[model samples]
Target: MASGLFTFRGKSSARADIMLGLGVAAALILAWEAVARAGFIQPQFLPAPSRVLGALWSMTTTQGLLWHAFVSTMRVWVAFLLAAAMAIPIGIMMSSYRVVGASLEPTIDFIRYLPVPALIPLSIIWFGVGEETKIFLLWLGTFFQLVLLVADDMRRVPHEYVEIAFTLGAKPRQVLTDVALRAMGPTLVDNLRITLGWCWTYLVLAEIVAADSGLGFVIWSARRYVKTPEVMAGVVVIGLIGLVTDQLLRAWHRRMFKYL
Candidate 1:
């Protein structure tokens, strides 16, 4: 059983996997609690998980934590959907047509390499400190990266699929839609999942500059007053949200592509 649990390239039941992950997490939390109780680290620097949970409860009950979380979630989803709407088509075009790829790839490559925080100032200038700026910043962070991933997914569709479509007397557009798009469905979903995680990461950067609410704002406000537990609580909330989103996407992927 021990060897099976640690087997190389081996699969385990979902229950076993979940138990293993939970056990590790519980152990880490217990260790953290012990260290905090023993004064191995200052509470202000690294609070115990229990303290963080307490802070989370306090904030949720009295400090509008739920509202802030909702705002941040909305911002992330709006920007992510917008990015997906634009990037998927642009990426398909880029991958399907050499001219589109040549024209857009260089510019995308250049912009994506630029640090997102650096763009914050320009985003502010472009869209002011309103919700637009926040959404744009989040969109910017995810869009470039997602577009590349989308293009790569489209490109990775086997040539034989296209050939078979053509052999069946399919039109060019049908080949693109039925053959290429369908072939890349799983990978495209995977790319979106990956990029959605990227979108969440940019939320702090998006909200830190000029926002009054959201998890990032809560975290930053707590940091200003040296409220370590609140800051850690905010971070924990974001991690939890991201983890839930990832798992949902994974389940969707598994359901949609049962053969895989």
Candidate 2:
């Protein structure tokens, strides 16, 4: 691979697209700053970019911000990985077995339609205000979505490839592992972006309910004290962190499938 404009000889247009996207972002920021200074918007509600950045700076020197970020991220990591582990197998099973799919379809659909927050009272009542309760919130919200997505995706895997796998003396299990999953991989890779957002939502729910620390906890605490800037600061820090993580994941995705 080359650097800069030659990074991909055919991707000159991609570079121009990137430039255009950045130009639009810059324009928005400039407009926001101009509007804020002209008193067209209240800083208290929609703070200027400079004030938001300053709040982020202030949070950096405080121990709470880093702790909050780390705690929230760690919880999300654990919950998301658990959900993925449980979901992938169940999803595969749903696609593989007619009985299982028929049995689960209605139940899963009903659960998906139900609001996870509505179950919070039950979750807290059953699990108490503990980590289990928080994890349940995350698992409940994400598992059904992942199961449906992965199962439908698996069902759509090119039948010809699976048929060929069977013709080659491969077992059903072998075909599923080597053929079906391979076909569904690109979509699974795409789901990672959605998974990140879902994980963030789980973090918010966890912090709102039982957490004494974490980004959402910080937000809640700041709101109580009317420290709007600190809350905004936490939002900025979280956004920046999420952007960095998302970029890294996207880069990995590109690198892994670049040859495709």
Candidate 3:
């Protein structure tokens, strides 16, 4: 009975994924047909998905939309990678030392709970209005979260892995390289993916104050002129870009670690 239930979950998960894909495809087709037929929504507002695609086509021809998309992608990529780079090292160090981890927990926890959006005012104040400010703002929102998450990942690794390594005469550095990092694999991927999504969200916030170009800034500019379709188009572009990035990351993970 236990075996049957466990096997059921694998089959269930596959079915669930298929259902989700089909459901999304169906809904999009319905929306596309409905909006195109209604014709009540002005082209400037709520352009049908087909119309949006047309706009996207023209955008590609002229390179305007692609340029903005690259700007947003650059911001998201640089900030997220920086956060991951800094967070992983710091997290490993903190987790390696019990006293350091204990002493730092309160501060890390406090910053993690603080409203990330609220930091924008101070980010601008400290960094001034420029790309650095935007990158720093995006970094702030994702950094602490990754820190706590990675530290937790390290802490949750089985003690037996380290014990066995030590009994086999492995040094501290060797155990960390072969054991601790390997143990953090799944958790690190999960956390990093989640953080990337948050960084995209934080990009919008970053643009509110300092960006001259990006999908977020484009959305705001379109909305200010009441070009809702363009606003929606910018939103669609961001969603697609994020989806592409996430799929690439998933593929990389699969290629690098078949066990996952």
Q: Candidate 3, clashing residue pairs?
A: none
Off by over 4 Å in 1: none
Computed on alpha carbons, the lDDT of every model, listed in order, comes to: 0.93, 0.81, 0.84
Clashing residue pairs in candidate 1 (N, C-alpha, C atoms within 3 angstroms): none
Candidate 1 lDDT, tens digit per residue, 69-165? 9999999999999999999999999999999999999999999998889889898999999899999999999999999999999999999999999
RMSD of each: 1.2, 4.0, 3.7
* Candidate 2 C-alpha error for residue 43, in Å: 2.6
Error of 3 at 43 (Å): 5.5
Task: Rank the models by lDDT, top first.
Answer: 1, 3, 2
Off by over 4 Å in 3: 1-23, 39-45
lDDT of 2 by residue, 1-260 (tens): 22454565544566676887789999998998788888876677677788877877777676557877888888877787888888888888898899989999899999988888788899888999877877888888888888888888889898899999999999998998898888888777677567767878767877787878888888888778777777788777778778888888888888877766
TM-score of each: 0.97, 0.89, 0.88
Could you tell me how far off, in angstroms, the CA of residue 225 lies in candidate 2 after the best superposition?
A: 2.6
* Tens digits of lDDT, candidate 3, 1-260: 12333564444455666667889998987887597668876667567777666667776677488889898889988999999999998888889998878888899889888886888888889889889888998888899999989998998999999999999999999999999999889778978998999999989878866788888888888789887667777888998888888889888888878875
Name the regions of candidate 2 deviating beyond 4 angstroms.
1-12
